[model samples]
Target: MDPAIASKVLPQGLRNRLSASVRLAPDPRVHYPGSDFPAALADAHILISGWGCPALTGDVLAHAPGLRAVMHAAGSVKSLVGEAVWRRGITVSSAADANAAPVVSHTLALITLAVRRTLSMAAGYREGWPAFEARSGADGRTVGIVGASRIGRRVITGLAKADAGYRLLVSDPCLADEDARLLGAERVELADLCRHSDVVSIHAPLLHETSGLFDAALLSLIPDGGALVNTARGPIVDTAALTAECASGRLEAYLDVTDPEPLPADHALLNLPNVLVTPHIAGAQGDEVTRLGRYAVEEVERWVAGRPLLGEVTRQALPRLA
Candidate 1:
C-alpha cells in the first residue's frame, strides 16, 4: 500500500472487518521482508487491496491456490490487478464510485472558483492590497464537461445546487442525447464544448483513443482566461502542451494529477501563477476509506450468499479503463 495512505487512512474497524472475513496474514511488514512476499501467497483466499497493494502477477498467483477474488477498496484497479488475474477467472470489484466523490467535489469547487477568479484575487490580495472589483459570478456561467463518467455526472448534480444561472455542455461518444439531458447537460462535440464554455473539466478514462486527447490543437480552442480542470489520469492530456499553455499565463489550470506525477522537486509548474497542482489526491481520503471498506464487505456478503456482485467488472469494459 502507498505508505502515505496506509499510515493515515485505514482505521481499526475496517481492518477488523477484513480480518474477520479471512485467515488474514500477519501485517506484511511485520512478518516478511518485502522481497519474500510471494512465499506466503498460498494462504491468501481473497486479497483486499488498496492504494499500495503489491502487484498481482502470474508468479504471485502460482503460490495462491485458494485465491478467488480481489476486492479493491479504491479506484483504477489497473495498476495492481493485471491480466493474469482476469485470465484465471478471479472476480474483482472496485470502489470507483466511492472514490469519485472527492474528485467531483474538487472539480465543483474549482468550477465556482474559476468563474469568480478566486485564485487570482487571493494571490493579489496576498501580494499587495488590491481594489475590489465587481465581477461575473457562476450565475449563467457555461460549464463544459468532457466526459459523462461517474465523476462528470456527480459534478453536474452538484452544479445544479448552486444558485448561479448555469448552462452545461457535455461530450462523450458513449452517452446518448437523452442521457446527457437526464444529467442536466446538453450534448455537444468536444471541440464545441471547448470553444464555448467559460470553464471545462475533464473526467474521461485514459485509454488508447483518449490518451493525449487534449493535444495542442484541441487545447488551443479553449477561450483565453478560461479555466481547465483535470482530475483524471495525467496522460489523458498532453503534458508538454499543457505546460506551455500554462506557462504563457493566458490560461488557468487546476490539476490534481499530472503526467510523470509528483513533478520534479523544482518543476516550473510549482511556481506558475495560474496553475494549481495537488499531488493526485482527488479520490477518497480520511473517512472515505471506510466507504470503500464497507463496499468490499457488502460484496463479500453478497458473494457468500450466492448473489451477484453489485460492482463486478466485466471483460468488455476492461479495454476502456486506464
Candidate 2:
C-alpha cells in the first residue's frame, strides 16, 4: 500500500478488525515506498500489499528474512511481486474477486448500452428519437467474450441469466469446449467471435501474445454499428484501429481502458461521440473500495487461522492471470 492510500484502504474500522488478529504495522511508510524505499522487514512475517507497493526484488527481500506471505488488498499482483518473492516460497493472495464484482456490473451496463446503440443514438438525438426499424434491443443480440477469465465467465453467467436471451460466444486459447458449454457460451476462434458478435467484450489478460490482439483486421470483422467494450487492460485493444472505426461511425466503443492510457488531450477518440473513453474507473472505487479492504482483512483472518485462502494466487498461475 502507498502511504497516501494506506489509511483509506485500511481505514480505522478495518484496521481495528485486522489488529484483533495480528499486531498492526505502526508505520506503513517503512515498507510502502518507491525508488528510495526503506522497508521495515525485520521481525515482519506477513506483508499486506496494495497499489504502489514497490516490486519485491532480491535486495528488498534480503532485509525481510522472516517474511512469509503477501496478502494483496487490490487486484492484479502481476507487477507487485518478482522472482525474489516466489523464490522465498511466500504464499500470495489477491483481493481480485472483490474487485471483479464491480467490473462485472460495469461491463454488463456497457453491454446493455451497446446493444441499444446508446452512443450513436444519443449523438443523433437532435434529429429525433429513433424510428421503430432503427431502434435496437438487447434480445437476440450476439456478445463475444474475448477471454474466459474470472470476469469474463461472470459476465457470461450474467448474460445467460438475463431476459435479453443473448447468444454468447467465447474465445480463449486456454478454454476447453466442454467448459465453454458449461459456462453457457459457445467456444469459437477469435476471428469468428469478432465476425459474428454484435458486441465484443474484452477480458483477456495483457500478455506478449495478446497485446494488440484486437488489431485492425479483427476489429474490421465486427459488423458495422457494432460496439466494442474493454474494461480489462489497456494494451489488449489496438487504440488507433479502434479510433479509425469509431471515427468512420461504423463502430462504437465503450472503453474504460486504453493503450497509451490517459491519452493525449487531443486524441481523436476523445472527440468522437461514438467512442466513450473513461479513466479506468471500472474497478472498485469510492464506497465500493471498502469491499476490497474487507476482503483483504478476511483473507488475513483465514491465513492467521490456518484456513484455506479463497483468493490465493500461485506463482505457477501468474502467466495466465490478469
Estimate the overall C-alpha local distance difference test score of candidate 1: 0.79
Which residue pairs clash within candidate 1?
1-52, 2-52, 139-164, 139-165, 140-165
Q: In model 1, which runs have C-alpha deviations exceeding 4 angstroms? A: 2-4, 7-10, 19-35, 126-134
Which digits, one per residue and each the tens of the lDDT, describe model 1 over residues 221-300?
99887878998888888888988888987678888989878788788778887888999878776866678767876777
lDDT of 2 by residue, 1-322 (tens): 6666676678889888988998876754434564345357666788888888888889888888889988898999999887888989999999999999999999999999999989999998878877889999888899999999999999999999886879999999989999999999999999999999999999999999999989999999999989999999999988889999999999999999998989999999999999999999999887787788899999989999999999999989998899
| All candidates: TM-score | 0.91, 0.96
The superposed Cα distance between candidate 1 and the true structure at residue 167, in angstroms, equals 1.0
Clashes of each: 5, 0
Which candidate leads in TM-score? 2
Q: 216 in model 2: Cα distance from truth in Å?
A: 0.4
The C-alpha lDDT values of all candidates are 0.79, 0.90
